[model samples]
Target: MSGGVVTRGRERRDQQNGQNSKTIEQKRDEEQVQHAEANSLALTMRSGLEAISKEIRDLKTEMKKDLTTLKEQVTEDVKSEINDLKREMYQQLSANTKTLQAQGSRIAEAEGRIAETETWNMEVKDALCKSLKQQQMLQDKLTDIEGRSRRNNIRIFGIPEDKEGDSAPKYLHQLLTTELSLPPNVNLQIQRAHRALAQKPNINSPPRSMIVHFLEFTVKEMVLKKAWQKKIVVEGRPLIFDHDYATEVVQKRKAYNGIKKLLKEKGIRFQTPLTKMRIPGTTDRSSTDPHKKQHAMPWQRVGERREGTARSAKEKLQEFERITQDSE
Candidate 1:
């Protein structure tokens, strides 16, 4: 029984040792499993961090590229706008300069025209003065010729019209002798006799005036002086004699009506036949003849100057050429 008891206790002791060894082995296997799980978790965390970091880097790169592209585009647009503005300014300045040049040229042309007009006016004035002086000289010559032509003519007025049976000169001589009651032997030489070259209505009408031409101017003066002294009447008609004058001389004589009236009122005897006022007895006479009513006679000078006639187109061109040569 003792041997068996000892052996049973030994067997119990061996079984306890085996069970402890199995438990130890199982604990060791559990520890190894936990360690493997921890290692796997750490590997997973590291891989996730790496993936996040790569994503961040990719985003930063994309943003940088986008910013660079934007900057380039903006710079190009600004450059284009600046170039356009510069070109527009240059074109506007050029146009303004051209316009100013055109206006300046027009102003210069107008000034030249004004200067030419003033010069032309002065030249025209000078030409007119020369023409007037030449005309005055011509008029003086005509007046001198007129005075010499009327030196010998005599006019007989209020003579009876006659259809003469004989020569007109002989009949007039006989009439003058008979009317003057001259001596029967008086020899009255007559040159020519005729009525005025005017129309006569009838033979019985108041007779037309007669004009007689004497052989000598002295004889005519003698006859005129005799007629002035004697009141010669034929029947109931009275005859008169005067100096034969031209129509212009007669008109000039009409202007002396005031002087004649004054002379008559003062009982002064004056001769009308002479061109100058001639007093038979007195020598003092005025040179300012009443018959001369013109402001500027042929003998008188014009005191005031007048603007001359405008030059003809041809003359103006010639003058312009002369002025241009002088200036050059």
Candidate 2:
């Protein structure tokens, strides 16, 4: 019985031991599952860290590139400012130099003008002194000439009669005393004759075909010469010169022509004649008889007996023939 009991205990002990072994194996499998879970969590955390590190490196690279670009921009801006400052400085310096140079030139010119003015004043003073002495001599010479000859009117020519502007009036008067107070046989007109010839409406003047006019004082040739030398008009058109007789003839001719033109315009009946005439009060030809009141001079040879005494056309022809025969 004791042996059987002992064997049963041994069996029970073995069975318990096998059950503990199975529990041990189950605990090991639980530990393995836990370890695998821990490993999976570590791998996931490592992958996240790697991704964050790459992002940080990329951000750092972009920041470095932007910083370099910003540095380059700042450098260019500073260089441009420096260049602008240099240009402004140079411009100011050049302007200052030019201003100084202009001031120097003005100063030099002012000094030169002052010197020239002083010289001119001295020359004017010398001329005035010399002119005063000459006036005394001229007075004496003039008195001697007056004593030698009787007071006579000398016909002078070649002086300006009409002009808008010529020599100063005072200067021209001075010329009359100095150049034209002449002796006999010497016409001061010779001095001005050449200029008149140059401007002779026949040919022309040189350098330019400027019509020059010489003043002709009525009768004093010496005074006229002085005036011509002192005063002359230079222009492109010709100057019209008229003598005393010529001007009178021209005035009469113009008056006659004007009367004729007025008569023609008013439609007056008048015979044309060699000399211009007027129509009675208007522009009539002059034909009148002194003996009769209502009578007019015979214009044509109307009566045969009247032809001998009266100034008819046939009588005028006979008179002209008699004069011609006498001349021959």
Candidate 3:
């Protein structure tokens, strides 16, 4: 029995040992499978990471290209806008300059016209002044001629007009001898005698004046003086004698109307010495004979009362100087 029991024990021990060794061998096999699976997983992970990095690099390259394109387009648009603005400004400046030039030309033209008008006005003024001076000179000459024509003639007013027919001259000669108290022995030469040329008036109207021409100038003045001294009367009317004067000279002598009226009111005897009328108290004629035309107006002597009325030379100079000032 002991031997049998020992043999079983030995068998059992051997069986145990065999079982443990098989278990260890199986574990080793499992470890080897796990290691192989881990290696395969690590390789797959590495391949995925590489794929992701390549995708990121491709995205970065695409973004850079888009940005560069956008930048270039923006620069081109800005350059185009600047060129359009520059062209518009240039056109506006050119238009303004043209307008200013036109205005300047118009102003210059207006100024030239104004200057020409002023010059023309001055010329017209000078021409008018010259014409006025010529007219004055012509009037003076005409006055002188008219006065000369009447130098040897006398006008007799208050002479009746009658139908003496062809004997008008003879009738006047006989009347001068009788009415004027002329010496019958003295041959008073008469050139011609005639009534004024006019239509016959009513019977009650004043008689026409008679024009008497004398052969000599001295005789004409002598007759006028005698007629004035004698105060001849005809048909109950007093005859008046006067020197034949031009109408202009008579009008000029009318300046003494106030003086004549004053003298008449004062009962002072006044006479017209020549073309100029005078008041006797102020000045006297230098002629010995008051009726002599030769000694007329040439010399005038102011009386003692008028000596103080004479103006000084300095006063005359002052007046001359003031003439231009006053005219201005």
Candidate 4:
């Protein structure tokens, strides 16, 4: 019995051992399967990592190439734009230089024209002066000639209008002979007698003066002297006689009216020869004569008594032109 029991026990122990060993084997198998799966997963993960790294490297290479090409293109475009700008600036500078040169040339031409105009103006001024001098000389000679023509004429004032009738010379001769109390046999020799060339005056106005031409200058002088010596009356009016001087001479003589009145007040005797005022018994040199001492009395030209020297016709003309311009 003990042996059988021991044998069963050994068998049992063997079975337990076998079952344990089978279990251990199963566990080992399971471990081996898990290790194999783990190995496979690890291998797959390594392969995927390697693929992702390769793709990243390839992408980096392509990006570098693209960046290089873009850099080159941008550099080329910048250089081309700079070249275009330089060319445009050069064109603008050239145009400005040409414009300045043209302006300079025009300025030079204008200066030359102005200089020529100035020279022409000077010549014109000189010519005008010469012409004025010649005109003044001719005018003086004409005045002298006009004065000589009236040397044998007398102007009578305070005469009634149309009193001389149709035959003026015949009527004036008889009137002067009776009024002046001249010799009946003596011929007054009145060549022509007429009223002044003016419109007839009204009755209230003074009558126009009568101009009488005598055959001889001496006869005219005699009539003037007698008329000045005594007052002559015809009918109801007093008459006056004077020399028929030229208009210019009369204007010049009128300028001496103030001086003549002053001289008369001072009881100074003076003679007027043409336009000169000569004080009797006074032998004084003219004011224009620098070598002699200037005196207040003697001979003084009318309109020049208070002036230094006579103005040239050119100067007078210039003054007249200035006055006319101012008036305008």
Tell me the TM-score of each prediction against the true structure: 0.45, 0.29, 0.51, 0.58
The sequence of per-residue lDDT tens digits that candidate 1 reaches over residues 10-75 is 999999999999989999998888888888888888888888888888888888898899899899
By TM-score, rank the candidates, best first.
4, 3, 1, 2
Clashing pairs in 3: none
Error of 1 at 26 (Å): 69
lDDT of each: 0.72, 0.52, 0.74, 0.81
The predicted structure with the larger TM-score, 3 or 4, is 4
lDDT of 1 at 63: 86
Per-residue CA lDDT of model 2 for 1-328, tens digit only, reads 9999999999999999999999999999999988998898888889889889999999999999999999999999999999999999999999999999999999999999999766544444444434444785785466446422312222223333333134433333344455545454433231122122243342322321212223434334344445445533334333222222222233445656665687679987564322234344563234322343543234322223322232333344577799999999
Backbone clashes counted, model 4: 0
TM-score of 4: 0.58
Look at candidate 1 and tell me the lDDT of residue 246. 62
Kindly report which residue stretches of model 2 are placed more than 4 angstroms away from their true locations once superposed: 4-12, 99-328
Residue-wise C-alpha lDDT for candidate 3, range 179-272, written one tens digit per residue? 8888888566778888877777789999888888888888887888888789787788888898878887777667767778998999988777
Which lDDT tens digits does candidate 4 get at residues 36-102?
Answer: 9999999999999999999999999999999999999999999999999999998998998898899
Q: Which is the leading candidate under TM-score?
A: 4
In angstroms, give how far residue 201 of model 4 lies from its true place: 3.0
lDDT-superior candidate, 1 or 4:
4
Error of 3 at 24 (Å): 72
